[model samples]
Target: MQIENMVAIVTGAASGLGEATARALAARGAKVAVLDFNEAGARIVASEIGGIAIKCDVASAEGAESAVATVSGELGAARILINCAGVAPARKMLGKQGVMPLDEFRRAIEINLVGTFNLLRLFADAASKLEPLETGERGVVVNTASVAGYEGQIGQTAYGASKAGVIGLTLPAARELAPLGIRVCTIAPGIFETPMLKGLPEAAQKSLGEMVPFPARLGRATEYASLALHIIANEMLNGETIRLDGAIRMAPK
Candidate 1:
């Protein structure tokens, strides 16, 4: 679908992949809304891109509903919803600290899996009411998963499960929303230069980059953004989770 003048909602837009996506969409002339728990960071990014910033905790149903309503009121019913809000807390089922706390696992699922579904449902519902475009498409949703979900390493129990759930949701969601001209797809990214990884020591980051089968470096946010834009434009691409890694199948730690 043509992005020009379309209303787009990007959650977790404060930093990392979400921030990059918001910028990419705005560059394509879409009216973007930057949603995140980080209000200050969201405002900065939104201001830079001439988009609106809405502070939101995507994990909460009420929060997601309120944010989507605000976006509709301020911008219009979104034609694009990108589910980039998630948390990746690495914790083993059994570690030096003993069995991992159940709450930790639940938190990951809540924010990553449930949160993704929440916005997707809300966005699709709102978009369904809009008149279809020439392509008969009402909207599109692009969700974020991770390589860990496919081949989780040690200490990735929680993170991997949450992401796997995202991958599993793709095909079913796409099928269910097809009648409404809403498509769903997922991106399972490999190690990238996100803020979470940037906190690691330089040596550690270098080591991780070397693990990639090719390019021998971390993935760039812009690269992910490019794929996202392509997905938005390519009507045939739906219900699939494309791996944006450098042909790397992660090794279990």
Candidate 2:
């Protein structure tokens, strides 16, 4: 799976890990479509990398379909799909006001889990219609999950459930799509320096970084992108949820 000239669509491409991935893929000669709700940011990135930008709400079925079709038409069929659009909220199952609202819980699932699946289905469909590459591979789909998916701690009811659902889907989806030569995988990140982590005190952020044991710091977006590149290059990495976390197990708040 040489990345050169491959077509890729990266959701959440306006910032954080998605932006890093789009830049990385483009650098390696992949034609990229930067998809994001931040239309202006998407346009900036697309302009930077000579890629296309599609403003989209990845959670919507129609939005996902239109974005995929647009990418397929302009960049050729997409052989790489990266589902990086997600939201994280740290709220207890029983909030201060009382039990958390059910819709709040469901919204996280809709955006993170359902959105990932929505994009995957469409991308796989587009990839399947195209001829296989010389290696007999049709495409690869990489999803983003959080370490919370595995070690959900306090105040993560909605976020954890959504990410956990993503982890649960990886294996079965990979198994079903394997015969068609589409690899599906997930990456569960530990603490990273992304905007989602805003509002934390600098000292708290540093303390969290110190918990990573090995690398002993917050992960960079490029670090995540680097592994993504490897997963795409290696054919046997399917159906697995690789932790990009620096071996940190979150503690209960």
Candidate 3:
């Protein structure tokens, strides 16, 4: 889809990858709706980008529906949806602290997996109604997964499962939406320099960055956003999960 004059909804836009994506889209002349649970941060970025900020909990069906409805009423249906909303709480099934709580695991699935599907469905439904562009494409969706999903390490039981669900969803969703000219793609990122990683000690962060096989650095949010823009523009790219990791196959911890 053309970025100019297009409408996009970027969930989890409060910080990290989502914030970067919203900024990139807005900079490209797209009208972006910054959706996030962090009202203050969302508002700050939205104001800066001349976009609208909608406080949303993407994990809830009602919340997702209401936010999407509001965006449609105000900025037109989003032709591009970048689902950067997700949680990564690392915990082992049986940890040194004992087994992780069931609620913790459930919450991870709810927010990461279901939340992704929630926004995706709403965006896909709305996009389907719109007449296709010259390329016979209606809209595009970009989801965030993680390297852990492919190779779940210790203390990543919940996070890995939720992310794995996203990758597993790509082909099926793309096939289902193919006739409607809507594409579904996923990005399984390696350790990125997001707030989550920055929270770790500098030494710890450096250690993780060194784990990458190439470049030997943490991935940048702009790099992911750039790839996402390309995916949206490339009509032939559909129903695939692309790992944005630095050629790193994670080893079990």
Q: Against the hidden reference, what TM-scores do the models get?
A: 0.98, 0.97, 0.98
Q: Write the per-residue lDDT of candidate 3 for residues 35-130, one digit (tens) a residue.
A: 999989999999999999999999999999999999999999789999998888977788789989999999999999999999999899999999
Give the range of the ten consecutive residues with the poorest summed lDDT in model 1: 86-95
Candidate 2 lDDT over 118-211, as tens digits, reads: 9999998888887889989999999999999988889898999999999999999999999899999999999888976646888887887898
Clash pairs, candidate 3, are none
Q: Which regions of candidate 2 fall more than 4 Å away from where they truly are?
A: 198-201
Clashes of each: 0, 0, 0
| Top lDDT prediction, candidate number | 1
Ranking by TM-score: 1, 3, 2
Alpha-carbon deviation at 48 in model 2, angstroms:
0.7
* C-alpha lDDT of residue 228 in model 3: 90
TM-score winner: 1
| Greater-TM-score candidate between 1 and 3 | 1
| Shift in Å, residue 75, candidate 3 | 0.6
What local lDDT does model 1 show for residue 95?
A: 85
Clashing pairs in 2: none
lDDT string for model 1 (187-244, tens) is: 9999999998999999999999999989899999988899999999999999999999
